[model samples]
Target: MFDHIADAVKLPDLVRIGDNLVVARFETMKVYSALAAVEHLLNTGAVQPGDTLMDSSSGTYAYSLALACHKYGMKCHIVCSTKADPSVVTQLELLGATVEQVPIPPGPMVDKMDLEVRLQRINEILAARRDVYWMQQYHNGFHYHGYREVAALIDREMPGAPLTVVGGVGSGASTGGLATYLRELRPDVELVGIQPYESVTFGSEPVEDPVASISGIGSPVYFANVTYELYDRIHWIAHDQAVAATLALYRDHGIFGGMSSGCCYLAAEWEARQNPDRQFLFIGADTGHRYMSSVYTKHDQAVSLTGLEPRGIRELTELELPWAVMDWNRRPYEVAPKVLPC
Candidate 1:
């Protein structure tokens, strides 16, 4: 029934794991956003079918955009992060995408600098080539449009129940887009965002994780598309705990997902236990193959989730290691001034 693999991959499996927990597991979740964005550009004449689409990504978005381009007859060029998986790069190249990785900087604590360099390189490319269109996945509103259909599906499946949607606050589009559309159908939809330590998105910059860059979940750059008002609560997960949760998800439910998925699962499980009256649905953004060596191989080292508990805090200043959660209350917060070099 689907014309392309991209169409088929975008469909998620909604599986109920507990009395109150449901997971919307995706193979590559961002394909929906990329496909919809590309189609819109073509339909509106903003971009022609043969045009080259460019963007900076760590992994999932790169693959997603390449798949979209292959489906729609557009060309894709990705400025990849230093942390991008080798398997992903191979796939992107095979799918006809031109990839250029920003070099890993010298010394420790290179996460923030690497991101800045990627954006700077993107600008250089834009300056040299007028024909190439930058998708600006992090700042573009078009990325949000793709999740409307997903919201409708969730609405129909879990009708008239108090629902809490949880996922990583990556570009802010995934969870933000879902909450935006879901609220239209039924107000009072609670939104929970999972973040990694040291990400500035939720003011966790004060605490730096030595592990640093957990690709696809946290970022060193500021994203314009992350609507601060959409989040009702936020959880900052540490890298070690994420690894444990990732292994646990496979062991417990046979769901092989990435670290971001583990972060969401860990947070959602706790949230579901806290609010038994509300039906909790968490987004599993991608599969675990990309993290086989980085995360899964450390299964023996992973700690038991039974002894772990997040310290609930009233303010961002109280955030600390292992895990922390705060009530954002769907309130808007000012984006901090950018101090990273451009």
Candidate 2:
């Protein structure tokens, strides 16, 4: 039995979608990251009980950190993006976490600007409050520790299997952390990262998705925690395609997951079809409840999943809209000049 709701929520439900494709689904995947990070901080005396843990989030990490703080008698303060769902903000407040929504700026780069504003606010908060500890989910190495247990679970579940992990690369903790530990057991394990159009994380910044930033998956800013070398391939998906895949996922497989899950599903399904001999695993980062109004309600605009496929390209400059994939070959890109230890 789990000791707390955070413990219960952090565990993923491994569900097989196809004969070779499996999805490690979570209520809020970052609970694992936040729990481990908080525990480590407390043990190391970086933070004490009742000290406020602050972080910037679109939604998922905010909820996870709040739950982690609630479980350990710590306080949580969230500097949220304008894109953060109203439902999530409500939950954060109810959980006793202080919330501040960054103002939506006027421009084409709203997503990027929102993140910059949030980070700026965080800097200001850190300067003023000595008791407030910035969680720095995007840069903290402690965030990666929790996923080692997940890797162990996968190793036990799929012993001696040739695995290709496909998932969204957000702060990079979930996909990067999982692959880092999984590689220790199977050196040949492949990791395919999914990103939304316009996310600078994997060189899709040139192109813009009309409906941009799929919550927790892609980022407008560079994440130090994202170990670029961990990815063997990267796929960029547009908003419409993710919506279609999300709708089809529930209609066909009954897994009601978020936008990141939808994007990962598309990549995983395609990869599974291409390499029938290999096993494919994708991550369902969170449930679709938060995306109901923003994504699910626009089901009429969603396209069919059958005809959809990623256009394979050799260079990052050749990135196109809707969907695209590149063979990253487990090499770090120039954008991430200094590789952070995994």
Alpha-carbon lDDT, every model: 0.89, 0.87
**Candidate 2 residue lDDT tens string, 1-342:** 878999999888999889999998899999999999999999999999999999988678899999999999999999987667788899999999999987877887666677777877888988998999998998899999999999999888876559999989988898999999999988879999999887778878779777655757877677889888899999999988888989888888999999899889988999999999899999998999988987789888777777777899999889888899999988876554432211
Give candidate 1 regions above 4 Å deviation.
340-342
The residue-by-residue lDDT of candidate 1 on 177-279, one tens digit each, is: 9999999999979999999887777888779876655667767667888899999999999888899999988899999999999999999999999999999
Alpha-carbon RMSD of each model: 1.4, 2.5
lDDT of 1: 0.89
RMSD of model 1 against the true structure:
1.4
Q: TM-score of model 1 relative to the true fold?
A: 0.97
